[model samples]
Target: MSDKKFELSRRNALIGLGTVGLASAGAGVGTSAYFSDEESFEDNTLTAGELDLFVDYWTGANSEAIDGGTTGSGQNDGGVSAQYVLNDVKPGDSGKLVFCPKIVDNPAWLWAGSSGFTQYENDLTEPEAEVDDTGGDPGAGNGELADNIQVTVAYCEPSDDLEGSDPSGPEDFETVRELNNPEDYTLTDLLLELQYGYLLDGYVEEGGEWVPTDDGAYPASPDSDTQTGPCICIEWNVPTTVGNVIQSDSVEFDLGFYAEQERHNENPTSPYATGTTDDLYPPFDSNRALGMSIQGSGGSGSAEAEIHNATSGNTAFPFGNANDDSDNFPADQDVDFTATLDVDSNTASLEVLGSQAGGTDVTASDTDVTDGQGDGNALGSDTEWQNGGIPQTVDVAISARSLNSDTTTVKNLTLNGTSVSPDQLAASAGPEQTYLVLQGIDSSAGNTIEIDGTLNIEGDASGWSGIDGLVINWR
Candidate 1:
């Protein structure tokens, strides 16, 4: 590790260069008899360590009216504690609020834009808007900003964080991340797009004409880069077409600023020459960036979308309040939690069966059924007996295979949502199979049967863990 202490300078002078030869000449006879020694010393001084980052709201063209102008202070400035807020903001409101991130004591490298930054959206789409420059007309090429709310960033003078206009001079700002084209953005894309080396209206004078340049992007540096400024101006916007589905919607985020040694940027580690334990132990050091949370509440009279179940799939049980009515549900309510099972009579038969007793093959006799019940291979020759058509003697076979060393209990069976306790289901312990039979059934269309019970799982159950809702439909 390098020294982190601040050092003071000590001055010393050497003035005996020519005297060395003269002194030796006179003492040539006995060199050691007239021995003389002179010593020169220099001090090694170190500088103090520094890494700091901060985020604050920038009141455009006026620093005194930062936080609603009540006391002319932004959050965390002086005694003010209220964070930056954008209220009653509808769509198409551009440049509503401007903020700046400041770094000092060390050079800061930042990551921004949709590619690197992430904002949680509660799984809903963000509001979309047209580029503010398009004059509210989204027909312009690459004009649409997919999210209902959008944030655009530009480099600005470090000393003045309140500027609303883009940087005009080459020395005004440094780009850390580049913004994405408006058309390529999604509703969930990062609100703030910071494109390195790309500027908003960024240009330079060459001869008589202004040539475009990468807006705020520049190389990383250990010391502050004088060619560009240290602060970035951030803006937010809402378009007019954003509907009420976003009503009462909100957005919160943390802006990050990172600082690392410039040495890493110049000579980074590669696969061939990865660092040793000592070199990689400390990882990298950086100061924490101060964060600010800005919240925007949607307008009143917000509408909601309706929820509907699939028409063809298994029936979906109601989730708490989602089944209350057919209209809209609150955006912040829990909707679904029930387990589902969909069964069709066409493929509801258990085609696989086996039986064992005392380590002997007993399936041949135990799995077959005579009259109604049997012990060995008790499945009757007639397979469609359980099919509900004209009410007749229906032989319903039940088989249980125990995967572990403990007995499993087949709780209760239900037919048409009504309990039928006489049909018992149980699997013996340790690879043992048990069978039961039902003799009467009107298995027909609209008749539903299900095993409504829990499996008493033993130390280990490889085949069947348990069943909560196992249903078979006869349609």
Candidate 2:
């Protein structure tokens, strides 16, 4: 029936702004402690034992170096720190932290939780763009690092040296124990799991989810005159296979500790419900693009491409992987693309297929073909792509440079599965960025677009021919 907290005040190990530094906090209200003697009975009523909690912390990185905590001296300062922080972390880098709790009075039920989970993409990198969740886009998307970093937490006994510093790994500790069969959760998933506070050993995995145990979290031991208290050691690392997608990302959160009176508390539940990433990455994602497969059938030239979105430029229109490619076609790739430009009828055709990530066959409901690739979507779970991201149609420009001798020509332009000829399209010098507007397209079978044109290269003409560009953008 009381409303006061006998819990240990929280010391934040915050994640900083820019590069996502591990900033641990330990300073709290400076109220001194009051302990009771081993007395059997008091005046008229039985005296309840005191149960105030305190904390001591330690951190380690790749070199197993101490980042300043209760490290050197044999005394526990009760989690005092100017800034127990670690910066300049990299991939394949693994580290551990021990947040030891002390009752300073009596043993009690302990709980652990996290809050203020924030993340930001900050800057965009190509490797990251390739594997990001469906909804994230540079600057306006979730961060990648936290989701890529995997963590494992366990209960442990401090090292024999009491130095609390491990040069090799947690194995140097006296004993490294687990809470049931704990899974190696990514930092992102772990944050969600700890939102409302986990009852520590008091929580168990039932069926498939983690829930509060019947008897509640186990009563963890507190510090004594001769030994340190049971420790909650968290070890985390970025896997080598995760690639460079998480570069230049940042994440922040607060690791908190709580305690309740075990003498009466049953089915303990935490009130801490703060689990939102400042800017974290979605676990699964994809991009808005012109999905296609190119196949050639009888011709002298090729127009092969599956890269590029709705807004690609004319230069990359027919082949490049999006107009943004620095080295287009045969330059960035090692293989040759093949598509036929009919030599007899002088006609060339290309058919491309479209279907959003996890989209089905539009075989019948082919009404309004989605106009543009909307803001990058969280494709899988969301199960839908919104329209109006980039323009649905592009201005297929055709400009050319010709030497003396003969001439190479392009005519009878067909776009978006329709035949629309302008200026008779019949050109001996290749039109200069011609503007042609085609209205209403058939979006059946997932918006399949077919482009057909006539090509006439006369007298070994001293000229070149190819699609100019797509003229849209990169999602």
Candidate 3:
């Protein structure tokens, strides 16, 4: 028979932080594809292709851990079980299926340390305290009195097809899906969508009693006629190894007193109550029905080509329909395909190239410097200096201002041992006498000129002194 195609959606999309690679095209990886044709998928219905089944387990509000126990405290710890049956297809042809449970609205309240009774009493009014000891307080030297409970479902591939014969024993026929740690699994809000069915009604066995009322609570007697519903109870120890599937045996939960008390409070006139007297009220009952269905799509036109893990080659694997049906298969159709890791030399080189572009490098530097000064003599004017024997010349200007008086003038100015007056200068100045040294002047033009490295000026009549100067070189 021709292979079929399919597309699977994630059930708990936001719960985990891991990436699930698609099987390769010869082996699909990192992609979700669908089939385009409908005819091919229908034609391959009877073909021996793989089948994928997803099973979900659901629990009612009362099924969660009540007060401090693993089951409810008030009513019988009765729960319901449900089964979702699907067509048996081949192993590889089926699409991915995910099962999730509904989130509990009213979680079980926990009582810490040895104060279970004290905590319970604190939560209730005086009249409600009458039934406090029905379940035996955890502090009363009785073992921990747990009022909370939980229901879970396990999934396994059946040894024998629903209709086929099996030589394997019952043990061999069942594959156990262990659910030892309820805390590790994802709890969803989807369980509310399931259709409930009854498996065990309100039946609390001996020594399996719980408090049933806030006032004068007592051990719950088995009631075949009690309003019952279905619930799936998972065993704490489920097998991890895969094999054939088996039907689970009836399990027990401690339906503590609160469930029955709440139920009684809801319907004071319930038939299960002892008297019609309004003040003499009975405890409440819990709803236990549970069911769920997960739908998906498939077809041959939608078959995904993936890389094979062992052969390292591309191959087609059947992913179910867009709408999760096993009957439809479209032939010779265009389907999406993805490639898996084929780390050849070229691929490795590309990866290395990508890394190189994002890297950085650091290094050191090189250069030089020179310093020289000539004719160390004190000068009262700005002057120019030049390298010996160089035709290039440098110019300098100097001036002094009077602080006490508004008028100021230059006293003496010199450059390279040559005396020069402010009047001999060419540059313009303010009210003060300033000297401007012309660099291109005769023999002095090529002479190196220097000062005490400082020019200090004192004003005469004004008794004020201010110095301002500028030096310049020209090549």
Candidate 4:
């Protein structure tokens, strides 16, 4: 995994002699091809021409062209730049590019070759560590670039229906039929497949032997009609959804396009493939290196923490003493409301001394007690509302633990006026069904809470029991 560069120029691509090497084989990008032909003795005196391949470039839009000239021992047909070079890429930076492999003198079977892939993490920084989730060893070549740059390789077909195809009208074959298809691969995956003679090559093992897969492959580019063949297009992107995990990272590799005479030839896999391509395809493994990145600078921001004391003021009630209280502040309640309720075990310190066995004595009193319902009529048997006039229905809640028995009863215990739910009373167990329960009671007026219950314990007490917590939400 040494640092390598796959820089290929038109000048170098035209020299096809020793180009059969792979990226790992030392050279950058070059095509590897060999064709077979038979002599036709029909014409004694004959004119012959070597089969050749020329590649032209279009920036996905078919708006501009870069003639790579003849990629076989021919000089440049110079217009602008003949090859693509991506630099200073950023998130959301994406588009497609087209490559037209123009065959001359003869139609040729072609195979796309890519090899010598390398990825570098570059100088890791704090910004990168903040978002990077690769969990790989630092300072290693396990960068995130290749995995973040998604690549969609598909054969283009001319159509007037694709968006922005009017420039070439019906003859524009640049519509990416399946650019964002579910089977799209990242750059690393795509390159790995191409190097192994698998992707879009039309040749795969069938019936226990290597054979041609007629579909999912580009037909041979004909020598007779240059404009007829479909263009091989690639749609690349560091998707907008990608984040800073790829920051300060980079990758390099060689994109090799190969070709051979189509006559009497069927299986044209990559030239650099060794042993068999079957072991690497059908289902790719998970050993992948891909991610997105961003360089340079921008603005910044920061954050800190603070503290508060709920000892006094609006949040100071049981709120300061009891964080579990559901009571609200004076301002939070109705302006006409002027009443207060105090019910805290440790704070109130109320104790009722009664007989150890069967007895009907469990009477307790608090500052304010409505019939646990919203009907706020204040006085008839209990105290009067400190404010005045007849009030509205008052909603009440209680959290208490009383020592008693299972058959305990509290008269007029209507939790809310229509309190018919068994959930209104919950218990903590004693020695043999003896209990510490919570129940509501009503006063002479239908709206006062009287805590009067009769205990019916028939056995010894003292057991492990206590209600953990309770919360009843009104839906």
Highest TM-score scorer: 2
Q: What is the C-alpha lDDT of each candidate?
A: 0.27, 0.37, 0.20, 0.33
Off by over 4 Å in 3: 1-200, 204-234, 237-475
lDDT of 2 by residue, 123-179 (tens): 555655566543343342256566667787777765657575533434455435553
Question: In model 2, where is the ten-residue run with the lowest total lDDT?
Answer: 1-10
- Model 1 agreement with the true structure over 163-189: per-residue lDDT tens digits: 655433223333443332232232323
Native-vs-model 3 lDDT? 0.20
Q: After superposition, how far is residue 182 of candidate 3 from its true place, in Å?
A: 17
After the best TM-score superposition of candidate 2, give how far the Cα of residue 51 lies from its true spot, in angstroms.
1.3
On lDDT, the stronger of 1 and 3 is 1
Top-lDDT structure, candidate number: 2
* Candidate 4 lDDT for residue 90: 57
lDDT of 3 by residue, 141-249 (tens): 1111111112234433224354554223112223334322222121110111010111111221234232223332222212322211111233221222311111110
For candidate 1, give the lDDT. 0.27
RMSD in order of candidates? 28.9, 21.6, 42.3, 30.3
How close to the true structure is residue 61 of candidate 2, measured as C-alpha lDDT?
A: 63
Model 4's TM-score against the true structure = 0.39
Estimate the overall C-alpha local distance difference test score of candidate 4. Answer: 0.33
**TM-score head-to-head 2 vs 3, winner:** 2
